[model samples]
Target: MLAVLVSLLPLVRVLPGCHCQSTNATAAITATTVTSVVSGSLTSKVGGYAVFDCPVPLEYVTRRSRPLVIRWTKNGHTVFTLSGGSLTTDERYEGRTSIVEPPEFSDAIATSINVSSLRESDTGDYECFATHKNRDLQLTASSQRPPLPSSQPLSHQSSTASTLSAVGTDIVDAGVRIKLDVQGGDIMSIPPINQTRLEHESVHFSCVKEDLESTVQWYKDGVPLDDLPILNGRFNVSLEGSLDIYDAGLNDNGFYLCRIMSAKGTFSAGAFLNVQYKAKIVYSPAEVFLAFGKPGTLDCHFHSNPPLTKIRWEKDGFLFDTYNVPGVYHKLNGSLYFNRVGKEHSGKYTCTPFNDLGTEGPSTPMDLIVQHPPKLIVVPKVLYFRKLGDNITMPCEAENVDNKSPAIVWQKADGKSLFDPRVTVAGGNLTLTGVKSEDRGVYRCVASNIAATISAETELIVEESLFHQKNFGLHINSTKKNIVAYWKRPYSFCTVWSRDTSLKLSNWNATATSSDGKAILWNLNASKEYEIMVSCREEISGESLFSKSILIHPKVAESDQLSLQELNKSTGPVTDSFDIRVERSGGNYNVSWTFTDNSRKDQADVERYQVKWYDAFDGKELGTASTEANKRHIGR
Candidate 1:
């Protein structure tokens, strides 16, 4: 009798410290053989492949020359077999089935089976059985459906992998090839994008592209811009991007875009094209006129970002040789220069300037008025004064014509310009202050502008003006041997006494108070005489004239001369009357006398009277004694 038993076994994967149970059963029976069988199921689909192997039995025995055979069956039909480590194809699958590795039996080893290039018809459940002496194990496999190919273009979208099931296994699958669209997104960068510019300067623009692999074509306003002088085969395409113009032109001024096509894509971009042109000077140098050989300054300025081109000088429409050529620093603002400026240097000049745009600037015409000789005149022509030591000044004036302030030279009759130290010239006028006797001369002022060939002269007579000098006179006095002297000056002017003989007065007391141009002095002595000389003078002209000198003496009293009859006053006609008196002081005689009716007496009767007295030496009256009484009085 044979007994069949089925049991389910739980598999434990080496869990920690779990005890395993083993069971053994022994039965005694009449000589009967039992074979152990193990089986599993496998599945697969079209375009899919899988493998299955029989599990090793729990109980086994060693046998000699025992061969394990793997049998492949389709729907319970034997279709192929694997043995001796070699796989053999059956008639049903002669050209369809292949095994990468043939199945072989071993004591305790499992085998692997490989199927390749499966088809839809190959989808099915397959049973694989391993047969050994008295033992057989079967395993079944089922093939599911193969994955479908994706229809979307990979070039347009990102590539993705799809999960596919074949014989109960998942696979990463892909379908179709992808490529980039050559004309998809073509773009060109605008050239000359930055417009950094300066007035009167030129600039350039170009076409640039980021992608250089495409055929580049430049266009302007939707029209192909080909064969341009700046564009050529050598400049067709550049890594820096595209064609560049050496210099931008006004005709080339437009929006330009470059078109390019490549396997990657097509691209185009607008290029901002700029043609730089130099700015022109709207006006030229202005003309200036000046007197020939005279000092003059011309002013000209230009209103431009770059300033003026070159400062040029001209004479009478002809370029001045002095500044005809450009100087090292001549470029820029306008120029100012005086030609030889002689009488011939006067004329109109034109200033011309050219701009970067090759445009000529407007000409500036300047008219020059040259005055060669200066005009001179005098404010007060005639001057006068009274004293030799008086202050005076001579002033000369020039004409106000020509609106030019000229230098005035005050020339004296001696050709010497007014005493250098005493003369001053300012604002076309010459002045001489503190006029002295020597300052009396013909003074003339000359104003000149040689360029204008014109001059004027004015004559000045610095005469001593009456009110100017007013020295009045010198008062002199003396007491005993001491003499005191003081002078009076004119109020119209201060009197100065100069050490220089040429200077009538050197010391000038300007502050000396005067009552009408006259200096006064007080406390003069009457004893000693003085010799004083003075002259009257004018203030502004410093002129002195009319000098006078006089001597002064003390007044004598009648008692200075004495006679007895003058004392008696009774003597006929009082011929020589004397007032005599005796004084004890100094033991000297004091006498007073005067002629009686001196004018009424006849010339013959006006006799020379002899004064006689008892001389201390003689003690007797001389023959000229009038009487004995007079003699006695004298003796007393």
Candidate 2:
């Protein structure tokens, strides 16, 4: 009789028709895997028959699937076996037990068995397992591609029922417990003796009592022997009637019982097996970056079943005991304390933690890098010679002292802020454009990092090399009909140029007859494009220095010329000129000059538009269209 009545629901997996490795594919879909467990208690009266129906193990045996082997075991001994259509029954179970279904499609029902003429003798644990034959051949036949050689060997040793199967073959079993209480049953003792052992050792639980038969079986923690985590072949029922477990493991420790059938009745007893193991780490030291002369700490923590007795530390593979080293001490809370971190303390470190039971791991080592300020590798130059308007740059390079890079800036050594438009610093380099005398000073490249800030300075002197100067640049202001050009006092023989002048070069192009740096071209032509530039020399006979060329497009009418108002305001060059206008009457046009400021009025009256451009504008002296476009192209 049972303590209470409970309704049990049967949920089974629907499998496909026969294929060699169909069950292996089901392993991925169904939860009724190798480790699936089922446990229940059964009772039978004296001199009567008992029938046990196992929970359905879906698709465990499919007709036409493969060569199959089935076994029904009590304790670790086979009570009945069916292999590839061949059936064998253990001597004591031969006529007493019979299968509930036909042997062919045992797939429709779980491993169900019946026993007749039940005596008090049949009390123990029973397991149902199915094994497939031709393992390698079955896996090979199901391959879509050639199998690759495994780098690491496959493992069959596991600590849980879920991991009991590997490639090629699978072991499926059901959990069952049977108890027959005829007489002398309640005589077993309380709090049975303990069978304690270390990991990986062998253990035995004897069921021998002089008059008992060899049909005895074993149970562990109320689970059938085959359902224990050790499972399969490692669990054996010896001929002398003892439960033998090989290569005992931590998970194997549990309450074990031995049940025997004697001439009088059933005898059973149990004992607890205690297993001991080592400790494991939970947290340890990590990479740390601490400035020199600062306090810091490293940590280590662990856990274990038996608890750890000691902790070890290693630095670059050598013992690192904080108590043995100066300026450092070990803390009671399992941390290393540093009085002041120094360069010598920077290196890879690892923590090895262990308890009395055992030790876990610190797979990777951590690093400690000491921090310090950056240092300059090379200093900037003391003197640099640059033309008054040319650009200049200074260099400053630095190297990391303790694996930390520094932030850099460009500044004046005299603590002056760097607000000049021409000054910019990048990667410790300083640059200045349009160099002038007032721009001269002691400039510095400053570097700062977490540790400290430092700087390097150099005195720079700017000189007016040759006759080149920033103010010497050309400026043009013109209308559609007239063009006036003027320059400063320091230069002489200022010559005007045009792209048309290059084509008839070597001949008619003559220098302007003016001694002062001033000239005017009064063309009275508003509908033409002009390409112009200026060249001047320190003396009339000196080599001419050229300025950037200018383009006056038709309809623009000095729009660009008025845009230079700010630049002209700063240079303050000579400002005297004349303008020319054209008046048209019935297809005839009149050209006239109007002088402004009157500073160069005498030169304008003599240079009239009719005497200079009468034949040129009419195209008599110009070349073909291709020649004109090619000669005046801006980049040319």
Candidate 3:
């Protein structure tokens, strides 16, 4: 019987914590033989459907005393059961799980169940039970009778035992078991691929899927955005896979991702958010004042994300261009450059910055005031000649005066202010009244305004009046036997004449006049006494001057008839005056004398003279000297 029980057993498979065993009854006869088998393990993605099969042989339930009962259990918990044609399911498996009937062409009476929307908790061992009531059957000698002999009957019995042994090795009569494995689910779609929100606006994003049991998560720029202290009140995510943002700012702009996770799989979707606003003019133009012929610049500053594409410059409410003006241009940093500013460059200027989002308003109008320095129009002469007690004037003029009228004044060449009562300035003209010799210096005319100062100089020369002198003296050369006289005249080209009182009218002599105030009388007779008169008259002014009438006597040469005592005693001529001069020459006294004759002639006969030296403080005669020349050297 044990052999028969072993032979009647069906094939059994080994699983984790699952075993199949069979035992035989001690009774000599049995009523029913049942074999149960389990199908292969089934696997499905999480949030998907899975089916478990239980194979039960039809012969085991045929002709049973009671109807069959089918039950499915997972991990020792009842999942679903069908008894007396009535189906029942566990509370957790309700509506989502169902039992399936076996097909008629299948050899086994099978019980199957489908689990929909599988989750991680549904992955475990599943058991199917098909139970039927047992009935008793008796075997006797008459039941063993057959159409064959007794020996043939034994062979038939052996064949039946072999068939039962094969069933016992492969099948199990306990129950059917099925293993289930749940995998992660997949994400279907995510709405709102990208979002763009203005400042202070709200935005929403959703991650959708078919599986209701899937878990949703949110991320920003690849980082998880959940329960972060920085985004505590700004960001939110719903259970239905929705992300909401409120009062979005520039910091909130970035790449956003929505992730869905389940037992089937993990999936995510990404989007980008961009924030935009209008540009603003951060720095406006300011007023600029520049000097003429100098360079200047004006800047127009602004702030924007896309940057400015163009900048327009305006002057005096009109567009400014380099085509019309030569020294104007634009700088790379959105500034206007004036290479050389002039009077025309003085105006109101504005700058406007433009970008793709349009331009900001024009900058504040800046006043560009150009000022010029003072320039001289009429210059003064370099030199001016004026007589004494005469009036003189120097003219000067200037242009490009500022609001304040230019101050004109005259100054001396020594940089001192001219404060004399004779100096006056009017209308840039410098005049001097009653010019004197003291005014004979360089005089400058200066013009000054708020902008600049300029000056010009002129030199003044004062000349004195001319005059003539009377009572002229004559000079006689006794050695040359000639008489020479010199006189002064008020003008050039004067006539000079001399006449002798003892001579006849035809004896009067006249010579050519001298332009430089000089005259000479030559070749006079010696040893004769006469009264002479000298006179001069200007050629142009007809003014005449005459010297006093005087008697002149000439001296004769010495002869052998005259003795030394006679020569000394004779009153041939007398000197009116004489001059004695002394000079030291290398430890020697050189004495010289010049004498004027009272008779206006030479004393040729007196060839030598005696000079006696005495001490002035005492009446002691120091020495006595004699020399034929007018000069002599006395040695110490």
Candidate 4:
């Protein structure tokens, strides 16, 4: 039993181990003793695969058959093959990777393939083998991964860490120590050398350090910024050891540094600045062109730090208003709105954005122009004739307004306002309701806005009723001669007359002369009733007037009658006789004669005679003429 127990103990310990191997015998037998082999020992950081320089040729052995078939692989994948002294590279490595030498090279007897830039995956075992008759003859070698080359050193690597003892001191030297033996020990990054920034723009600085959690102190020039009263709203400091300049300007631009209150030591970055201010304009002159009595709006945007506490706008050196503008006097989130604008708004405007920091941004100025007042336009200037009691409407139009407030007002020539409370002025237009004859004169429209006011006037002609004449008259007379007569108008100086079938007579004349007096009509006819017309103009509206017609038939008589008689001596016993007779025929007269002699007293004594007559109308007579007594010798 003692022997069996001792044997069982040995058996138990070795039995478990041997049993485990027996179960995995096939895997163990197939395992490879692929120890790492190195060639081309000098390593480089770039290449697609590991390379090796064979010390000897694979076909050096005397055995012939396949001579020598060498297989090259990386990470268990075949990369190339060598048959005798010939080499065949894999397709993947055709162009991107290549061998420096052919397989048969005598020099070094070997060469390596150069892949492109190396990758981490390229790190793996690389094996080469010699085969005879397609069977492995011997394992040539394996190349272990080469060590990667180190990075290039920084250009200023030799220089020590730079430092600045003063909080705001700039132009610091390298390899300096910070000691509080004298006073405050703080540092700030310097502004970049000769750096230029637009005026009213922002500038930022960061105090970089390996220990980002360390506290950093910032300074401008040589003063401690945290102690200065000039730290209005224009400057700011960040918790991440950074400084911000909301609006950096020429005065704000200087040496700056950031010093860390590190447990070890202080470090800093030095910078210099050259702040530049560009010329700017606050308003757009082209879009703000305004007409006389018209309104305008000008834009003003400027650079400001901490944003502008206030933006004061001015016109022609006069106070305009303070504004909160969006993307103009302030950032895009600002606010500014304009009310009614006018001609007074035209001119140069100044926009200044500032805070207590002594005004850091540009003050822009823009120009404005006032244009001509709007013209009044009326539609259907001559409306249809309205009856005495009819109602009408007249619209006055005026446009191009910079401001649409307060509206427009309408007024008539008669001093009475039109439309009154019922009138409405919208969009530069005036509407009139219940217009009457008195509204027929010239009407004036006035446009007013915050900036300016303007007015336009137009005439509204109104026709009178046909049956509304003030006076009507007629005259008749008896005559012995043709009468020349016309109606002597009364002293009613403001009147007109017409004489035609249509009430709208082309011959109608306003007998009331202008300031320069002259007869409105000249010629007249007699015996027949002469038609005359008159009209009375409205006192307020020259367009409103009444018309009247009248007929005048004046009496005229023949004052003097002349007779002509002639005798011939040679023809004795011959006598010529003429008779002068005056009779009334519609206001004119006619004369006739007959001559008788011993030759033919029975023939009724026919002869020729000459007669003349004078008019009693104006005391004038016509010329004399001869005619046969049979024609009655009619004359006047």
Best by lDDT: 3
Per-model TM-score on C-alpha atoms: 0.23, 0.24, 0.24, 0.23
What C-alpha lDDT values do all the predictions have?
0.39, 0.50, 0.55, 0.41
lDDT of 2 at 609: 21
Structure candidate 2, residue pairs in collision: 277-357, 278-357, 278-358, 279-358, 307-355, 307-356, 308-355
Judge candidate 2 against the unseen true structure and give its global Cα lDDT, from 0 to 1: 0.50
For model 4 the local lDDT of residue 545 reads: 39
Candidate 2 lDDT by residue in tens digits, 1-636: 111121221111111110111121222212122222222333323223333433323344345554655566777787777565555787765444555443442344323344543334555655555555533111111112211111110011111111111122222233332332222323221112346676667776544444434256678877888776566677787665566778776667777766666565665555566666665566544666666777877666655456456667788888898768999887765567889889999888887767665576652577877787678887686444455787888898788766667888887655667787888777778888888866765677888876567888665544332224325455555654345555654564565654443343321122232346555554323344556555555343233455555666555436645754554455332122334444433444444444455535344333222222232223243221222110111110
Candidate 4 lDDT score relative to the true structure: 0.41
By summed lDDT, which 10 consecutive residues of candidate 2 come out lowest?
Answer: 152-161
- Candidate RMSDs in Å, in order, are 40.8, 24.8, 42.4, 34.6
Model 3: lowest-lDDT 10 consecutive positions? 148-157
**Candidate 2: where are CA atoms >4 Å away?**
1-192, 209-222, 239-241, 258-268, 277-306, 322-347, 353-636
Clashes of each: 85, 7, 18, 35
Model 4's TM-score against the true structure: 0.23
